[model samples]
Target: MTDFTEYAKALRARIDIALNQVIPETPNSQLAEAMRYSLASGGKRIRPLLLFAGYRATAGQQEHPALEIAACALEAIHAYSLIHDDLPAMDDDALRRGRPTCHLAFDEALAILAGDALQTLAFELLADTPGLTDSTRVQLIRSLSRAAGMRGMVVGQAIDLAAVDTELNITRLEHMHRCKTGALIDASVTMGALIGGASDQQLNILARYSRSLGLAFQVHDDILDVTADTATLGKQQGADLARNKPTYVSLLGLSSAQARAYELYQEALTALAELDGDTELLQRIAHYVIERRH
Candidate 1:
C-alpha cells in the first residue's frame, strides 16, 4: 500500500528543518522566542505539503532552492494567522496544537509582536529567496501578499468577527470561508505552480482544483469542530458554537455538511483530471484533506 503518511512525515521533517533555518531560535530576543514557539508547535503542515505537491505535479520532482523558502514562508504566514486568531481580540482560543496558545503562553503584546514579525518575515523570505528570477520573486510576493492581506484573509476575518450570532446563507458562508481560509490555500497551490513554471492553462485548472479543495478543507473543519473532542482536535472543540459562529454544520446540519465536503472533494478531483502531470500525490492530498482526523 502507498503510505502517504510516510511521505507526509518525511516531507514535514524537511519542512521543519527549513523553517528552523529561516528563523533561528534566539535566546536573546523574547519576541523571537514567542515566534518560534508557535512556528514549531506542530500542526499538519498541510499548506506546505500542498505547495510541494503542486510543484512536483507540475515541474516533476526537480529540486529548487526557492521551493523550500517558499514553503517556509507559507507556513510562517499560517503560523502568524494562528497567533493572531488566538489573541483575546480574535477567537480568544487558549489552546492550539495541544499547547497553550501564544497569548496564553506569552504576554498578549509579545504574541502580537510575534505575529507581526512572522507576517513580515514571510514577505522578506519571498522577496529575497534565491533561485528565482526577479519577475518570479515579484509574482510570488504579490500572490502571497494578496492572499494574506486585506483582499483575502484579513477581510475574511473581519467578516467573521461581524458575523457572530447572525444567520448566513450557504453562498455567503462559502464566500467568507473562501476569503478567510481558501485564499491562502489557493495561493499555496498557485504559488507552487508558478514556481514550477506551470502554463496558463495549468494554472487555471489548478486554481479550480484548489478552490474546491480549500472549501472542502474548511467544511471538514466545521464538521470536526462539532463532532471531535478537544483532546483529539488539539484545541477546544465546539469553539465555534460557543462563539455563536455559523458553521456549515450549524447551518446545514452534520450530515449535510459531511455531504458538502464529499461534493467539494469530487469537484477538486474533477479539476485535477484536466492537468497533465504526476498528480497522484495531489489526488491523495485532496482525499486526505477531507478525511483527516485532526
Candidate 2:
C-alpha cells in the first residue's frame, strides 16, 4: 500500500495556508479571534483533503488557486458547524481538538457569532472565487449552501436531536447520517469534480463513492468513541452515548459496526474503480477513513 501520510500532510499545509489567507487577522475583534481559533484548532481536515484529492483525480493538477478557495470555504463551513455543535445548547462539550471549545475559550455569544461569521464568509469566498466563471461560482455557492443548510446538515442535526433516547432503525440512522455528515462530504468531492470539469458520468460515480464513505466515516467515529479515550479522541469520550444518541455501535454492536465500516469501504473502492484519472489519492483516503484510530 502507498503511504499517503506525506501526501496528506502537503495538502493539509496548503489548506491551512489558504484558510489563514482567507480569514484576515484582527486582534481588536474577538469575533475574528474566535473564528480563527476554531479554524486553527487542529483536526484531520478530511473534507478539504477529499476536495483536493477529487481535484487531483479529475483535473490532473496538484494545485490550483481556485481549488484553494473552494477547499477553504468548505472547511469554514465545517469549522462553523463544529463551533455550533459544541455550544451549550448543542453538544455542550468543553473540549475540542484537545483545546477548549470556542464557547469555553471565548464566550457563548461570541462563539455563536464567530460560527455565523464563518458561515457567511464561506459563501463570500465562493461568491468571489478568483478565476472561476460567474456560473461556476454560483454553482459552488449553491452546492455548499444546500449541503450546509436545511436540505442537508441542518435537517440531519434536527433528526439527531430528536432521536436522542429513541430507537432508530438502520435505514433511519443511515438517512440521518447521510444528511448530517454525508451531505457536505458529497458536496466536497462533487464541488471539486465540478471545478475540475468532470463529466456528468464521473460526478455520478463520485457521488456513490462519497455516499458510502461518508457513512463509514461516522461508523468509525462511533467505534472510536467507544474504544478510544478522551485525550486520544481530542474530545470527551462517550459523548455520543452520554447524549443518548444512536450510533452504529449502539444499535448494531461493535463487531457489526466494524463490519459495516469495512463493507462501506469496499463500496467506496468499487465506485472509485469505475472512475478515470489518477484515483490513487482518493483510494488511499478511503482506506484511511475505515482504518483510522481516531
Candidate 3:
C-alpha cells in the first residue's frame, strides 16, 4: 500500500515546479507577479493529481513530456477559473488558499489580465508539448477548450449566477456542478488516459470515476462551508449561505449531503475497481475528496 499522504506531497511539489517553469516571462512586471501570485497560492492540487493517478491507473510509468505539460496545463486552467470566479461579477470572494485573492492582492485589472493570460497559457502548454503526436495534441487542446469554454465551466457559472436565491433541485444542481467542477476534473483524467494510451473501455470507466469524484468533491465543499471555520477551510465560512447560493447542504441538509458524498465516493471506488491496473491512488483520492476539510 502506497502512503498517499507522502505521495500527494511529492506530486504537489513536482506540479509546483512544472507550473513555475511554464509560466511565461512577461515584460510587464505586474502581470508576471500577479500570475505567479495566484498560481503559487497553495491548494490541494487535486486536478493535477487526478491526471497523474489516471496515468498510473493505465500503467504508464516511463517519463513523457505530455504528462507534466498536461498536469500543469490543467492546474493553470483551474487557477484561472478561481481568479475569475473571485471577481466582483462572479463569487466576489476575498480569500483563497488562506490568502488574499489575486484581485485583492493586485488590482482588479491585473487580476483579470492575469486570469486571461493563465487561460491562454494553459492551451499554449498543451499545444507546445514536445513529444506528443499532432493528433494527440489536437485532442488534448479540443478537450480542454470545451471544458473551460461556454459549454462547460462558463455555462455552469452562468447557471450558478442565475440560480442565486432561486429554487434548485438536486438534479439541476448536479448538472451545474457536472459542468462547472466536473468538466475539468473529467478532462484531467481523460487527458491523462489519452496520454497513457487508454483503450475506449478504460476511458469510459475512468470517466465514470472522475464524474463521481467531481460531484463528491463539490458535495464535501458544501458540507465544509457549514461545518468548518474560515481558518480550516481557507475561505469564508458560510459564504454560500451568505450569498444565498444553492449547494448540497442547502438543498439536501447537512446529514443528507454528507451521506450523498459517501455514496458518490463508493461509486468512484466501484468505477476504479473496473479498471485493470492499479487504482489505489485514485481510490485514496476519492476518500480524500469527501474527507478533506479545506
Candidate 4:
C-alpha cells in the first residue's frame, strides 16, 4: 500500500515539474520572468493536487493521462490570479512565498501582461491536453472559465475590494467569499471530477464537498492571517487588520472563526461521505487545509 503523504509528495513534484515545462524561460521575455517569479514561488500546490486526488477518489484511475495537464492548467489559473491580486491597484502585496511579488519582482506593466498571458495559456493547455474526449475537454474548459470569470472569483474579488472599510454582515461576507475564494477552489475539485469522467451525480456531490472545503479553507486562512508568522506565510501578517478588511476574525473574533472553520470542515467531510468513495486523500487534504501553519 502506498503512503498517501508520499503519494501526494510525488504527485506535487510531478505537477511542479510539468508546470515549469509548460512555459520555459525565454530571454527578452520579461513576461516569462514575471510569470516564473510567481509560479515558482513554491507554495503548496493544493489546488492541482486536489484535482488529481479528487479524480482518484471518484472516477477513473489516479493520475489519468490527462491528470498532469488538468493539474497544470489549474495551477496556471491560480498563479495568474495571484499575480493580479498582488498588483498595486489590487491587494498591493509586496511579498509572496517569502519574496517580492510579481509586480514587485518585475515592472507592473509586465506583471499585468504576464497575468494576461498566463490566463490564456491555461485555457490553451487545457484545450490541447491529449487523450481526453471532446466532450470532457469542452466541459473542463467551460467549467474553468465560469469559475474564474465575472460570476465567480472575479466577482468575489470585486466584492472584497468594494467591501473594504465598509461593514459586511456574515451573510454578505460568505456570499462574497463563495464567489471569490470558494469559486476557484470548487472549480479545482470540479475540474478534477470532470476530467476523471465522473457522473453528474458524483460531480454534484463533489461540488458540495468542494464548496464546504473552500469556505473552510478561507476561514482558516483568515485565522492564519493573525496566527501565522509573516515569514512562514510569505506575506504580511495582520494584513486584514491593517487594511480594515472584513474577515471571519474581524467579524466573529478568533475563537468564533476557529469554530466556523471546524464546522465547515465537518460539512465538507459529510459531503465527501455523501459521494461514498475512498476518502482517505480528501480527508487528509481537508485536515491539511485547516491545520496548515502557513
Query: What tens-digit string does per-residue lDDT give for candidate 2 at 141-171?
Result: 9889999999999999889889989999999
Q: Which stretches of candidate 4 lie over 4 Å from their true place?
A: 24-27, 60-62
Model 1, residue pairs in steric clash: none
Tens digits of per-residue lDDT for model 3 on 176-221? 9999999999999889888888899999999999999989988998
Over the full model, what C-alpha lDDT does candidate 2 score relative to the true structure? 0.90
Estimate TM-scores for all models: 0.97, 0.97, 0.98, 0.96
Q: Which runs of model 3 end up more than 4 angstroms from their true locations?
A: none
Error of 3 at 280 (Å): 1.2
- Writing each residue's lDDT as its tens digit, candidate 4 over 1-294 gives 277678778877887788888885566577787777777667788998688767877774546788788788888888999899889999899988889888878889999988888898889988998988988899989988998899898999999999989999999999999998888888888888887778889988888888999999999999999999898898999988899999999999999999999999999888888776666778889988999898
The better candidate by TM-score, 1 or 2, is 1
lDDT of each: 0.92, 0.90, 0.90, 0.86
Give per-residue CA lDDT, model 1, range 63-141, as digits (tens).
Answer: 6778889999999999999999899999999999999999999899999989998999999999988888999999899
In the order shown, the candidates' Cα RMSDs to the true structure are 1.3, 1.5, 1.0, 1.4
Query: What would you estimate as the lDDT of candidate 3?
Result: 0.90
